[model samples]
Structures are given as C-alpha cells and as structure tokens.
Target: MDTGFNWVKPMLLMIALAAIPSVSLGAGLPDRIALDSLKNLYDSVQFNHAGHIRLLKDCAGCHHHTTGNLVEDANCVRCHQNSSETKVVACRGCHAAQPFSAEAQRKKQAEMKLYHQDKPGLKGAYHLNCMGCHQKMGGPTGCKDCHPMNKTGEALYNTGSFAPKKTGKAAKEH
Candidate 1:
C-alpha cells in the first residue's frame, strides 16, 4: 500500500509549518505619521514614526498597557475616549479649540476639564506625553525643540532630520 503521494504531503506540511512564523509577524513601523488630529492652534506635527520606533526599541514606549505584547498598534482615539470599552474618539472631538457656540464651547471645556482634571485639554495631553518623555530621556525640553517656530511666532511643521534605522529584535524577528 505504498502511494507515491505520501512523501509529497509531508513535504508540503513542513513547508507550511515553516511559513507560519513569517505570517504571524505583524506589520513594521510606519515611516511617518501626521499628529494633526487637534491641529487648530498650531501646524500639524509630523512625527517620524519609524525613527521613533528605532530609537525607542519597544512599541510599548508610546503604546502602553499592553503588557509588552502588542498584537496590533492601538489607536490613541481608541482608549482616549469619553466612554471606555475602546471607542474611537478623535482628540478634537472632545478638545475642540473653537466650538461653534458658547454652549458648545462650554461643553467641550467641561468635558476636557473632567477628562483631564490635572492637566487640561488636548494640549496638556500632548505636552505631558511629548515633553515629559523628552525631559526624562534628556532629548529636548524646549518648546521650540518639539514645536519649531518661525520668526513671526508661527508654529513651523519641522520634520527634523530623523532617518529611520532598523530596530534590533523586532526588526530581525519580522
């Protein structure tokens, strides 16, 4: 009862099993991401996502609370919402710079006040996240470092010369 196809099946199975690891590896860090969700008062911050990935070495540096095993990168809007259970609410959705009416403005302010009791609005969150990290890491503390300004006091969208370098373990694994 010797079938010639017997060897073919096992060979195919081995190949399929070998390919599983590559398939399981998630997507690589993006080259760039525009942090313009709340860009009313200033120019949109152009983040070098891949460069940050290279520098940080772990996605958990920014995307916390995942126990260091990020199946997929969580969107900021997912958890940073009015209600819990991972609802997608944009930064400006709650932290509107200029609401339509006084009532709307008041409501937004109230929501922001309640949400960010200690800090404040979206600006506070940005400052806390960016400036806090910068200060801790000894990267840059100045406001102008993160948010570049022109001579006329306008916020310049400064995409600093950050070339993406390959991250160590994560990049190699992928």
Candidate 2:
C-alpha cells in the first residue's frame, strides 16, 4: 500500500474542506452590525449580517477572503491566492474611513507595496459593493433606500430649504 496514490487521499480531503463555505465560522458573529465608518452624509447602516449570511452561504460574497473562504475574483486571486483568513473581517480593516485625508495619503506613500494603491475608500467601497449586488439581486438601488439623507446631506444637495419653492400657479394648484 506504499503506492504514490497515498498522497492523493489527503489532497482530496483538503480540497473538499476548502470547497465547503465558511458559513459555520460565522455562527458566533453578531446578527446585526451597524456600519458607521462613513456616516457624514447618511445615517449608519443597520446591516443585517445574519440575514445576508443565511441568504448567501458563501462568506466570500461580502467578506472576501477575510472569512477564510477562497475568493473567486480572478483579479484578486492574482496576488492574494495564498492569503489566509485575517483577524479583522470588517471592510474598514482594508479600506480607510478617510482615504483622501492627509494622514491616509502619507500612509499610502510610506507603504512599499503599490498593488493596493488604488483601493477605494471606505465610503466608495460600501456604495460600490452594496449597489452592485443590489442591482443584480433586484434589491433597492436608490440612494435613499439604504441611506436616509441626513440634515447635512440635505444642505449639501440643496434639498430641504434650498429646494425650489412653488411659485404662483404651482402653489395655487397645491
């Protein structure tokens, strides 16, 4: 029984284990997580973490490789092929909350790695990921759907008070 096929069994077992999604690992995670890394323009998102987990058993759907699931994104796999699960699974871990700030710029310049120089900031990451998935899933893609515009946002967009007032005819109709 000392044939070369002995190694094949262990290799197949490892492959099978890797194929299994990491949903079980998320059992202890909080069901609802408040995403407030970027809350200046809108209220914090009360993300139903557990609901998404149940809906999509694949942890890489949201957490990428942080949940120990191998990512299927070809671009990501190029450099992160061997990347293991990281302790921090939050988006803020990789995407800076204030990516355009002076401090963030300095940090980026200091890092020797140039591969991730164009990584989106926390806000951009949230919008891109959430909106893209929502579009395909037939979920809400409107700006106000997930993020209720706050007073600051209203003023910035010239909304609330800055909205055009009804003139003579329009006012009369109202």
Candidate 3:
C-alpha cells in the first residue's frame, strides 16, 4: 500500500522536534531594567524566579489567562486567599497601620546609626529559592541577575494600578 500518509508521519515528527527548541526561546531581559548593584537595593527585596516557576508550572498555569500578566503580589498568601480580597488575613493586619509598620520602621530607624545592626523584616522566600536555583543553573547571580526593581516585571500580574480608570463628575465638582 503506497499511502501518502506514511511519508506524512515522518514529516510531522520532524516538524514537532524542531518546534521543541523554539518553545524555550528567550532573547534576554529588556533594556529598561538596570543591574542589581546591591547597594541600590536595601528596602527592595530579591525575587526568586526559579523557585516560583517550578510551583507555577510554566507562566500560563496560575496567571490569569485573560490578562496574561505576571502577578505583583508582594506576599504569597495574598494570591492564595479566596477571591483575592487583599490578604489571607488583612493588609493592614499583616502589614499593620502604615504601609510600612510605623513602630518597626521607627525601631529600625533608631538603629540605623548602629553599625551592622540586624533590623527586623520579612521577605519572599521565592527570592532565595528561585535565585538559588538560577545560580545553580548558571544564570546571573546578582540583583539585576534576576529582576529589575525600578521597572515593573511584565510577567508579574497586578490589579490595583491596572484597574480601569473611573472619571465623571468629581466629588469636588458637585
């Protein structure tokens, strides 16, 4: 039987194999981002990319498909909670009072004068785990190594700033 389908099978296999390499395409990070000097980053936290991607199962899995943006949640619990209310608990509750804790900030500021003081703080572990893996994978090993603090990460999905702008009769106009 000289069926044309026999040749088609091999051709399709070849095409699929070629596509596999294309799937991993990455040119490089955007130019808008700057290198992580470490000095420029005191308050800015490190982001662990390798660790986060492992759990998410590629970018498409957890990110809202409709939006196609990386989430900008500073903490993990914020995204895990029901209906994305703000926190697994509360924003002000976890952060407490000011955007930065007033009391803690005061305490840290008080110790700013002391050399090598261990100020209290919490950071996303994804930063460590993911960055650790990237270095192991022979990727960049500094702050700029994985992220651009000044410019927004396109993959990171966020809502508040992206929300539709509402405009009409201002409260002042009334």
Indicate which candidate wins on TM-score: 2
TM-score of each candidate structure, all chains considered together: 0.43, 0.73, 0.24
Pairs of residues at least 3 apart in sequence or in different chains that clash in candidate 3? 36-144, 48-126, 48-127, 51-130, 70-155, 70-156, 70-157, 71-156, 71-157, 72-157
Ranking by TM-score: 2, 1, 3
Better of 1 and 2 by TM-score: 2
Better of 1 and 2 by lDDT: 2
Query: Lowest summed lDDT over 10 consecutive residues: which window, candidate 2?
Result: 19-28
lDDT (C-alpha) at residue 106 in model 3: 88
Tens-place lDDT per residue, model 1, 1-174, is 469677988999889778654323334334666876445534567877667666776654654433233434345335543323223223444444433558866765777745333334556655666787888888778756655543334423322333235545668888
Q: Candidate 3's residue-wise lDDT over 55-111, tens digit each? A: 444552323221224455545335433333232321123322332477767866887
Q: How do the residues 1-174 of candidate 2 rate in per-residue lDDT, one tens digit apiece?
A: 779689999999889878655553534577788987547877888998777887877778888878747987899999778998888988888888888999988988998488889989988988888888989998898878887878888878777766657755798898
Model 1: residue 159 alpha-carbon error in angstroms: 22
Q: How many backbone clashes does candidate 2 have?
A: 0
Candidates, ranked, lDDT: 2, 1, 3
Clashes of each: 0, 0, 10
Whole-model Cα lDDT per candidate? 0.54, 0.81, 0.41
Instruction: Give the residue spans of candidate 2 off by over 4 A.
Output: 1-28, 166-174
